[model samples]
Target: MGEKRLNERVLSPEEFVSGYQYITEYLKAGLPLCDVLKRALKYFEDQFVDSYCTIMLLNSKGTEFVNGAAYSLPDDMLEKFMHIRLFDGLGTCGTAAVRGELMVSPNVHNDRTWRSFANVVKPYGLKSCWSVPVFKPGTSDIVAIFAVYSKYSRYPTQRELDTLSAYNELLGLIVSNYKIDDSGEIEQLDLNEDDNLNSKTLYVESIKTGLKNGEIYPYYQPVLKSDGQELHGVEALARWEHPEKGLVPPIDFVDHAEEYDFIDWLDEVICRRACEDMKKLMDDTGKTFTLSVNISAVHIRKQNFAQRIEDILDETGFPADCLAIEITETSLIDNLTEVAVTFQQLKNLGVKIAIDDFGTTYSSLNYLKYLPVDTIKLDKTFIHDVDKSPIDRRICKTIIQLGSDLELDVVAEGVECDQHLSIIQDFGCNIYQGYYFSKPLTLEGWKNYLEQF
Candidate 1:
């Protein structure tokens, strides 16, 4: 096979930061190592053109490679990788594992190291391969191999290699902290949680400063009527504006805040900021709009949770009746009785309550029977495929009916197109929120968006 030269592309600094932040969020969320690896690869593949990525682990004896995760690679090819032993010139990944360094084959056909895998890769038209060994942190022990494949033969620029190296380090952190069980479940090892937090104390402190500096604030995503003709409300989402990293996504740090037992502080900051912003928006626009804020389970379970919310309303002068507190189904699993008490207290203050991401957890429908919920936002997973999947459509229709029978507002989440809107309308869901209307926007962006209406 002849070599085919292709234009080289490198990941921008912003792209690198965003991708790293995105994957770190999953790791912090305690997702399975394999699932996190797959998502990490997907992020890279989406950034690069015609690229595929895979991760393979070193066995306990460090003798052979085992499947960890692969993106868009055929099972037969992945099966071949399982038998690759660590040795010189065995294959790109195998050789990288043995040498404990990065390996590159600009053209697999011309690289003698890939001679043994020629037949295996030919079917997929894999022209180039780059492999980097992921070592255990603070040690030279090889734990995993991260590889990227391309259909066109070309050498990667230095910048591209640097990006790979940066991500390789992150993979090391993930792999070193997690392990796969015999039942194929990803279980977290008994790593000392306190030690982990102590190690990242600077990061935690930075968040505290970030809030005081106004670096952490609220962004709003509009929730519209099912007809897409009028704005029903807006959801306040927290975002971190890192001075150097630009916009750090909430996923990257929200869980970290929760783990460090300071989520209550962060939640209060967001709620107060959102109330102030929404109050101003309502005043300027002369249009009353409901404001929804997601409260962490940690904060909601407190003995004085309702009192704190009432204080923020009093401080910001935001009407209590026009505000909604969205609680996820998973949050209600632990302390339903206590949470219901808080819900009733808030309801007594004229605040509305909403069950966000409803149907994602195993919590019984008895929640609706006991809790004072005014709305249930159907989990986006059901709405995402409502236009195509019969099962999703049925679930959405059933949820809408249930909401109606209970005389509660039903808001469909994740309506991204006209088809989703039409189908949701048919199901009699009059409230909608999703990218179909607009993505979450900064305060200025939200102001501009509302001005148009």
Candidate 2:
């Protein structure tokens, strides 16, 4: 790719140092930031004649900019520019704030990014705008923006742009004063709390809409035989195809759904999709494999937990025995009797139960002795260092032995390379999963994977 060209004019070394020293003195003197902003804007405008200066800072949510201080800008324009949302093609300041880069529009009338907000600036006789995002020192978090608007269509000189670091330093010093106390405790900036809440609310609602629209679905990761030669089963993992954000990883929104009573419905969606994919694979290749779907503790606590599984199976025509419901060790620890009942009811319906993420929760394996689980999934920690650490190897060997004694299959997770595979197989784990075989795949990707056998 070609180097990104910025419209910058050169400034003298004395000019750059003078600007830096001026801002530094104000910050060191502990002047009120509002006063500092006014003085700073005037100083910048004096250096670059026929220019107006404005400052904007990110609200608590970090999605938009709030007007901080301005010099030589019209009162009418100031009111309209009070809040500028960060988005693609959202004018000079907004784009710079969102993209975390320097934005220079030599001609607002000609720039596509200025299309939406051109009229706001054109009326003020501003033809060019240069914006630089101010980030917190040693962090990517943008705290504010410092911009200059000029009457002529031109970009800042290279020498003038060199002072951006000084601008950022001053902006950070001022913005930090807005949040951090004398004791250095970060105080809540309630200025945009409602905006942040609204943004999150919309995001959560979008997930709900995505689920309804079938934009959210399952991606299958194969659980393989210990030697990594055959597909034993595939675990259904949820993924969201967000319109704006692209493919969002499950970690971003999985807990959001679980928190909002949406996971139960999402669980059904995953089950149905898994069933459909499995049925298609069977018809295409006549090969049948087990399917596992994770069940959250909240879902297990539901009164209709077992019945919900049965209903999904009957509704989707998925084989009952071919489906395994993975409940975590933490779930069983919470409501022992209730979970026992839930598992027993599921077992009666021929749905296999596996303890997911074993060894991470309680050290007590008392629940394992009573729960009717067909498999015990050893946590990733056991395999992460099993090859080099004797303790990890011994712990894994003991877990596999316990599973063997109880007539239960033991699955070792995070089996990444030859060492993990060799160590895990030696420990007698019945199945293993991780990058050694393959990472999770979409339905089409999994079909290609299953085509081998």
Candidate 3:
């Protein structure tokens, strides 16, 4: 059979009614606006196969779109739509928002407005785009833009447009009824909050303030050679020095940052600070040390992510070759292809890539084959019990051997005790990072520690 035509598949009335109920129930239950939009887009995409949908909410100033939620679009593509101006001849969504009308581009290639974004969407095989401006309830003011993209080059049928228009109204109601806070938390216009919820909201706001005030900073954890205890590198761990709390651990704020989609900002701050500090340390000590920094998956998914790293390097005078980006195993598996592309981009700049918390995720081995990873920091779980558990010992041995076969450096984490170090040494893993050697230290503490070393 030939390929299915885009116009032939119309959203049925039953499907529309079911989706409407589902989305309304989510809103009534006080779900996050982004989550609700995702569900709605997923429902629509399910109805129209090979299609993707996105909802871009207008910023408070109504100058640009922000906080976009897309069902199938990659983060990089969705990012391009963020902060897009409300202007005609800009793109489907932008033009729709500007004109407050439905904008259709049967073929993006032939459309003049799509020229700016053609290169970005082309790689994803998105050929057709139809966008509708979602207005605030009982007002002509556009609060959001709901866009549909298809792989095929064909205009949406009248039935399809009608279905989209109905969904657009539903989106308007959802967008107008809720307000997204600075922390990305969605709250209804007239919703009551519990004490715990209020506490969480306060903490999230504190994190935002901490970032601006420079309370959130990097703490260095030494990575040493297991054989000779010689410092091989240092991993930059985020630490918050709150005035009232004294010192707040990442356990308290990192998850909250990720939850609120502010991790990217936090990650950049840590990366930049780490680079600047490391540069000074290197210059003062007259020695070069590898600086490894943990990057959240949320930050890595941004468009031109590597370029951002390069910008930091250029600004701080940190050599790319001496920097290693440590990404957790789970992060790599979430979007392997896109992450691999990012890894390669980093590699091109001579920055090393290491799979942090390796062996925690099932797809660790699979990722090694595809990713241009330079090091494998075996998860602490395997090393913590390697001395007591025979299974863990064997797994550690296998990972070290696998790393050897792949010619990649294997760093054993949680080598706190002599027994843990001995076992990993026997397994032929050389790099070590854990509390037995040194805990993550403050900037001044790191300087003192280095002087003592």
Candidate 4:
């Protein structure tokens, strides 16, 4: 149906009631949340052709918006919407979440609200959008956003508004009601809380303050060449030196920053610090050395991710080849295509890419073959018991051989004693990290350690 027909025809009362009743039946039948959303989208799309639909809901902690359901959107667009912080004038749904109001952009190309976001939606031919904030029944607080999009630029008609109201009603019911699985067990709808719940809430707030106050910083851990006891590089690890809590481990706050969706800021801060240290090493010793920094998937998914890194490198005058980006295997799952593109850009810029905690993800080895990676940092699990367990030793040996065949450098992580170090070296892995070499240390400590080498 074209926009003209969509504007003229009001949905029949019987058809609207049946659509809602079908959703209620689907819920009662214990369908999965995504299934119900898919059904709802199909129901709406059958009436409004050539249009797309989306459902965005706040995470339990109210820190970010995640895709509850999306129909007819491409991977790049979906990836762009994966994590949105509820802030003013972010985008259609983000702004709706921030204000708890309906947002209508009849012409995204010319709409003032879409001025900052045209680049994200223009490529998809998304010309118009109308979104309503989904609120809990008894409160003004938004629980989710119900949005509809048109391929052609035009305002939503009165008939479309009525259909939207119908969809919103059904969606609100789904959001507020308890959900059950096919196996007759209750399923928790939201998974945004930390282990300590409210304490985590307070802790996360403290992390925000800590970030602004310069309390979160990068701690350098030395990585050594197993053959010569020479300094190879240092991995930049984030350290939270909380005033009252003493030295807080990464485990305590990394997740909180990620959960709050500002972990990118932490990543950026550490990258800048590592680059500064890289410049320092170059200036003091007149020697260029690698400075490895871990980058979150949050940074990799951006279309302009490489440009952002380039800007940093330009500011610090750090050679791109001297910087290595460490990403965990788990980050490879969701945004593989986007990450590959970003990696290629970085590689072209002379940055080395390393996969950290290598074998931990349920990912295919094909990524190892096709992705632009320079090194593999074997997960500590394989190295931990290589001296005692034959299985562990064999695994480490195979990984080393695989890296060799691929012409990729291999770093065996968690080499704490002669036993672990000896086994890894015997397996043909010459690069190693962990306490056997040195623990993560402050800048001064790292400088002293470097002096010894």
Candidate 5:
């Protein structure tokens, strides 16, 4: 026990065990993630008063977020704390992960450990720390982090560590229950209230707000030719420039939007914005090229979604041949035959389809044969290691051959260095996009960039 505990008086073993069991039962009772975290927080606070606690679980992207049902943090600062990643030398949680050891820091100011995050604790007047990685059930994959912060400098005693370990296992089950095996469908996970179906509707509204407020804009990354010197059309990536917060990357928020069934709105906003910019590009430069927009599986599942596409294309006055609709492997699965019929209508309208993030899913190749799409975007990973590995080269060659057989355009994404280009180009494949050509440019920024060179 710490000197603080010694002074506060000894904790009975039963009292400590009761606290752990209470946290366990609270988490195991199918409580939402936020509630579970909150209960754990309150339990520790009551058991050991004056202690502040946080539990962050891995978001879909394995990124940061305090499980909401669990943490009652201020919304204003939630993003700040949630953004703290668990990585080596990142912060207390990260340091603990790297060493695979329990971390206890009694001094916030003087400790050289995780000095980078000193600013985080300084504001809250927190000087002491304890963090442990909550491993996934039966696997070493870290699922979440349990952390304790105290306003005082005294460290945690052994009882706290033992109690937290069981709590972590219980939390992992909460997360595992919500894991959607559906590889690509947006999950409507209400960490606190899954019973309330209206929560998904609310999630949709948030994504809409993200769209209405200029939180979403197009970022253009140049596509390069085989020579690497020539620039082709720029890929219009949706960039979310949040008003209060700065840029929120797609990886950070896209799937969250998808989960709310508002992925339709995201597609609508991006498609509309891209079409508008495409018009401006033609007027400014007189150079016509293709702008591929990613389509969510949710939208594709709707038989009428194609009609919306037609309306937007007509409304924007962008050339039909100039736009490409990119769908993932899991798209249109809700009604496969119906999706095929819809694609035919799209093809008649002169709209093209390219399977986005291809090869991430095993069924992607199979999906292509069934749908009469015009393109296949080789996922970034294959392009990343195209030349280095034999298997990667074979996959690249296979995809190129497949595209050739289908008379489809095979586009490679995320080409960075010269070797990545050489491997793709040598395979006799055409069409590539990534930083190798240029990083994603802004709408006006892209226009100026193309005009300059």
Candidate 6:
């Protein structure tokens, strides 16, 4: 690392900031961003080697990642890479989208997260990477990314930060001006409300797409009644061991049911797997505990909701009392008044409801008057902030008090750190769930996880 060589390899702040301002001023002058990027690369080439840059503007819809422009990139490479929609491990652009921040991949080839896109991005000798978020002027929603690249490993200087600041502000203006069109984003499935969709039919596909193919399966996240560290229950988390696509997390496709009115099948699939696992666990360990699965509003609206549960419980030979149904307030609202009668029927059969994502909505508290839930699980958003924000602490405290006064148990979800544990312990919320104890694991995995206790 000689002085002049190091100075040239790493960006000088003054140079980077000056270059940043020139690009912004150019864009503000009404030049299309692609043209502006092209001009900026030309300017940088005349000045420094930090001229290789890519301006990735998000589609008008925020759903997918799109590579719109790359300065100094081969035209063919740009066109080919641009077609890649954003997803986890989907190269630099998609990783940035998921983390909601600019991730610098100084060497995209060696970074495990971006390894899949290596061949596509490595040919340019792109060793240095810089990505800065372009956001709406006063909002957190990131509209795009202005990624600066170099042929060597480069770190940002003060001048580089200044350049990024100006670049982001200018890019924000361009993004805010573009109108979002979400057409072609959602594909509608065929079949009517009365049609009992076949498991093989694409229309019947829910988040758990591979259950029919035997790839989608249940994993249990162990829940301990804190302090005693005793296994009280487990929630079934679904995973897709895709043959070609690799492992997929629930956040990736868990909403397909709510999105396509196919939630019922997803709920049923997870329920069946969870009940079967519970039965096996009881037989093996002789320690039976509750197993909770989420129920969708889509299934609750069906006339046979109660009978459906009975069928599954009997089929699996699992105790009806050893199960809990979790539902969100939004799902509760989907058919609240009508479903209340059905929930009451299930309650008579010893099924308890835990309101998931509680306190995330304003209407959650009021629903206690209408629903016969046995527990109110505090949403993690409030728990995450319990130590920092006074408002969140007060609300959580009030919620615990409310649930206690209503004679319903309060389970604090996302109880990660000891601070969260201490806080809830003070609030008399004895039951807790979160990654600190353990992340969601397969039933076989849970047996190993339980060894800690």
Model 6 misplaced stretches (Cα beyond 4 Å): 1-209, 451-453
Candidate 6 TM-score over all chains jointly:
0.54
- What is the Cα-based TM-score of model 5? 0.55
Pairs of colliding residues, candidate 1? none
TM-scores for every candidate against the unseen true structure = 0.57, 0.57, 0.63, 0.61, 0.55, 0.54
Model 1, position 84: C-alpha lDDT score: 53
Per-residue lDDT, model 3, residue 26, is: 70
Q: What lDDT would each prediction earn against the true structure?
A: 0.80, 0.75, 0.80, 0.73, 0.66, 0.67
How would you order the candidates by lDDT, starting with the best?
Answer: 3, 1, 2, 4, 6, 5
Better of 2 and 4 by TM-score: 4
Clashing pairs in 3: none
lDDT per residue, candidate 3, 1-453, as tens digits? 011121133344355556667666676677777777888888778766568888888876666776778878875677776665666355788888777778889899999999888887899888999888887643557888888899999777666665665455467767876885433355667545423443454456566667766788999988889463577889999999997889999999998888755677788889999999999999999888889999998779878899989999999999999999999898766799889899999999999999998998889889898999999999999999999999999999999999999999999988889999998998898899899989999889888878744
Tens digits of per-residue lDDT for model 4 on 193-256? 3123334434555665566566788899988894537877889999988888889888888876
Candidate 6, residues 82-198, lDDT tens digits: the string is: 545666465656677656675777677677867776676678777766666677644457777666667777665544554354345435654454443333131222223212322
Please give the RMSD to the true structure for each candidate, in Å: 19.0, 15.4, 15.9, 15.4, 19.8, 19.2
Best by TM-score: 3
Q: Candidate 5's residue-wise lDDT over 222-252, tens digit each?
A: 7656575565565668888866567777886
Clashes of each: 0, 9, 0, 0, 11, 2
Output the worst ten-in-a-row residue range by lDDT, candidate 2: 1-10
Count steric clashes of candidate 5.
Answer: 11
Shift in Å, residue 49, candidate 1: 59
Q: How many backbone clashes does candidate 4 have?
A: 0
Which is superior by lDDT, 2 or 3?
A: 3
